[model samples]
Target chain A: MTKVKDIGEQGLLERLQRFCPPDVIGDDAAVLVTDPEQSLVVTTDMLVDGVHFSNATTSPEDAGWRAAAANLSDLAAMGATPLGITVALGLPGDLSVNWVESLYQGMTECLQQYHTPIVGGDVVRSPITSLSITAFGQVHPNRIIRRGAAQVGDAIVVTGVHGASHAGLKLLLDPQIGKHLTTTEQAALIKAHQRPQPRLDVLPHLWKILDNSKFKIQNSKLRINNSPSPQSPVPSPQSLTPVAGMDSSDGLADAVLQICRASGVGAVLESSQIPLPTAFDHWLTSEQALNYALYGGEDFELVLCLPPEAAKTLVQQLGQDAAIIGSITSDTKVLLHHQNQKIPDQVLNLSQGFQHFSP
Target chain B: MTKVKDIGEQGLLERLQRFCPPDVIGDDAAVLVTDPEQSLVVTTDMLVDGVHFSNATTSPEDAGWRAAAANLSDLAAMGATPLGITVALGLPGDLSVNWVESLYQGMTECLQQYHTPIVGGDVVRSPITSLSITAFGQVHPNRIIRRGAAQVGDAIVVTGVHGASHAGLKLLLDPQIGKHLTTTEQAALIKAHQRPQPRLDVLPHLWKILDNSKFKIQNSKLRINNSPSPQSPVPSPQSLTPVAGMDSSDGLADAVLQICRASGVGAVLESSQIPLPTAFDHWLTSEQALNYALYGGEDFELVLCLPPEAAKTLVQQLGQDAAIIGSITSDTKVLLHHQNQKIPDQVLNLSQGFQHFSP
Candidate 1:
């Protein structure tokens, strides 16, 4: 009798994927082809009381915002525009009504930012608080991004700096860590951990850059291939190659590895090119900062794979907001590039990300 | 300073409804008009350990079946056929892998019966296990049923006998409850509770009956009133009066009250006409059976409202599967009728259904 701990979260997910339908569990969000022209993308994430957040550290409002952002970030990763969401909450009986209301306020405020509404929900009593949010979005079927679509020679791009959230989490959990920082710096780091903004605003730029040339070709091909069957016009992976994408909720390294594994390719991450927030300079060593930048989770930033030209265009257009930190490889190993080293870089550290079941 | 226990589940939902968008939280499922021809109905239900189910009373397989059935029942209430569902799970690490696999097997089996697939999911670690399922379904926009559409003079109808599931739960929790019943009778009742079926098969008959008369008028009106705007063709409540509906997960009496409140109408339940399974005869009195029939939650049956003619047609088509339990009234009160020597019925007992936060 194997316990869930023995197999861990990844093993459990693999078990589910084997049991589920082929197209169901592999993507950032499940794509349901609603029509020939459009597809519906749906994703769900569950946050537990002790596992994801604690009352001592996260305010009810912040918890609500973070939960909403997590789901919204998934939609963004799939290149889908917001529609609405359903929230199912399990709360303790002793929780104050004010706390619940404040939580709603946070969720609503975050959702409103992206023009998404809370469409439906169920509330039940439990010993510990937990929130499960399911977000729905719509995208042109040809334009939907996937984790398995990273082509060889594609540039690996990431949005925003990392590690601030993890640092903030550390600071919140340990007051001694805050002693070295100024009050303003401490407040900024704490805020980063408390309120993560889903990179929904960057989606339009991503689509505009990737969808322009490839999408027009796919559109013409679709028109030529249109048949009586509704799903016949849906472009296949070979017909329209999308940028591999997912949000960095489970740490940057894990996000990249997931894409590589899904796409059956390798990656070369330039250690010097990876973005670390300036806040890390206040106290952390260069190596410590790099480690946090690579493996610290809950960034809520976009990780994208695109052709070099498209990546260049994205970086040129977005300027400081985006970075091309690596490139896809034919080899089936994720490696890192040392700035002054020759030929090869060591295989990237396997000790990465926060696994839910890891001791 | 108010606690969730003070307000209870209903009160918390009311609070959510007040804060959510007008069209968001009012129905068994929120209907999103995707195209002029179709609407997408989405509903979510969360089941928690100790609160909704216990390992002592329920197998993981049964828990999965119950959770899936609960969401499927919501889709049925809205006259929507399921498309797919996303399950977000929170499990404790010490749980056996077999238990988790069995849970998925039960969910998949139940979903497969209705051709609904598991499309997406997320799993996380938690102190207490919980399952949150969000179900997606589709229906013809004009034909979609609503909770707030019961008109005065409409007949109140119910599907299948009630109280069996609640009795089954009692038997599972307390072995003494089975003392008077034969083995077959006990098994039947226990099965009823563990594996309640969603009334999806009866939906076609319902649509065939109700849509034949009212739908034609509404469809013709829609064509004549079709405007350049896409949403303009969506029929208003005045244009198409659908049969008010919901599942009996929260007890028959509570279901009746919800519809009555939503539709701004009163109801008269004929006490003698309410259906109860024959298993009740083995151990329970007539009064006890009636209480269980009216107030026993988790039946997963349908409570419907229709014009007397339509109701008659439905009963004629469904036979024993459905029964005319009562009628809608203009007065704003829900009452129970006595079969003999009664000009007026008494107000229904307010003590009904399972309230999640109540002591």
Candidate 2:
């Protein structure tokens, strides 16, 4: 019997190359060779066997989609349009062909939605399953929105309500909590946890809003063009400036702290101003909601700071869905204001953010 | 202990999102934003612990460089200019940091040669070390080549001599052979096995030759008009016309058969004409050299077929470095003509290819 180690590294690579199609088989990465006018965008994420998922619960399909989506979210974060992806899968000998096919199906679904294809990959047998996906996208070089560009005095806003994914996870993991929820409620929460959507819809609108900020003095010309009549007037675009922003992958508190760290500023959040789902109140106390919103991770929502005038205009433009839950402050510390009192200084320092190296 | 399974698929992904810098974190894969006009090429290879390298004999640095080189060779085979890479490493907790850093250092050196940066990657603990690399390259779309395009009656040419790497491996694994060679000879053989170069220098010349082929007729007219004498001739560009081609990863015989199958044709190689390295002769018998050339894998040289007229021009242009080892034939079966006799059919039919699924 030949073991993988017996064949050696160069030998194993030689064997894997036999399976690749001659076209797109060799190159740094498989080249799409698409049009050159659009710039390329790239992202990567890794999954460990015991750390990322369990073979007992996660179907290969969900694992595959989640692996791809983890990287896709980065593209969405940059406001880059999706292109294609390459996957590197490590599997134990016990892995079945059926498992790989199902995983591919899940990945196919995500790729179809983004109009990207699986260009190439490497598959090798391992003692455990560790899947890593690297995705690429296209965007105009000038349109890339980085995390460091946020400004001070921008209205701090979040795209959606936080705590649903984390709450759903708690319910799924603990059967006791599952017993309290109806089947419909349980399914909704699980779906949110399993297949969260990247906020692709808001990208174009966000880009347009940012582009409008480039020309402040020419506001009258823009207003006149937008107005139906020459005499009619519209609000100035400068009043709606978006300053500093980031997507909340960590808890809201942690994400806000990161944004402040990047912008060299601080923030204060009003406890009453934070939004919560209707069912959240039924499951948790107000304190729990605050805790979940502040420290429970995986919200996948954008937290942004914009000018007060821009806040009003943005609200008018984006409607009531976007929430203004906090304000940037000069105090140089992220503070939670509750019931007309400042929380204890020690309470604000809780370290709940995810750490990759933590055992 | 927080097990990955307890977290579920979505929970694990959310956890991953927390650590990834939101700026370049997700999409179907990571989108490496680069200029659009630049050609994009991709290659991927996987190395499993025990199969590719053992902790006892193979150093981490060699393992890493070999892993990167395997993919880089595919890019070289495509004549694409190397650019960047993403790595996915699966490690055991017991593995030392010193080992991993050495691996990174080796990979960094190889990447630096091509000016390709390590754009992103995922690192996770596994039961064994499994490394996967996907590299990217840039080339003009017109210059990019594919393995399926080899034509019938094309001259089969190969870059450099084959079997040195395999000979080196034989010497390293067998101490008996090591004792037969002097210290200098052993070192040379070991070096060949450890560091295989991807021929990047020939890429530009190959591209130039391919470019000239496209407009030969139009260029002839322009040449006539510009010439001092009407009879002055415009030198014909060398041919890189591979109707069907592939790297000799699975031994020359298997790769040649692949080209034959892809082109729906066959091939004939003269046994006496096949180039064998001096070291190959020292370690292997004449019969063994034939066997290794037919079945011994890890010889990254390419096997290409070009039209007879083009072959003459290519041979002249490529000079002695590139050898015309064989030719595409009309027959359905790959044949070897030795002297006047065909030898026994069993010798040519010997299966000499690497199979990943072989138990």
CA lDDT scores, all candidates in order: 0.82, 0.60
Supply DockQ values for each candidate.
0.73, 0.14
Clashing pairs in 1: none
For model 1, give the TM-score of chain B: 0.90
Model 1 has a DockQ score of: 0.73
Clash count (model 2, backbone only): 58
Task: List runs of model 2 lying over 4 Å from the truth.
Answer: A1-38, A213-246, A304-321, A328-332, A339-359, B1-39, B213-244, B307-321, B339-359
| Candidate 1 per-residue lDDT over residues A184-302, each given as its tens digit | 88888788788888988887787787667754454344335322125335454344644778989878888889899988889999977888776678789766776677788889889
Q: Interface RMSD for every prediction, one decimal?
A: 0.9, 12.4
Candidate 2 residue-wise lDDT, B1-359, digit = tens: 45444544334445434323342222112222244334466666667888777765567777777776667777776666776677767666666555666787777776667766665555565677877777777654334444544555667877656666677677767758667566777777666566766656556655455456543443333233222213212223222223335567656777677677755677787766677666665666677776666676667666666555545565567665567877877776787767544454322443433231111
Error of 1 at A319 (Å): 2.6
Among the numbered candidates, top lDDT falls to 1
**Clashes (N, CA, C under 3 Å) per candidate:** 0, 58
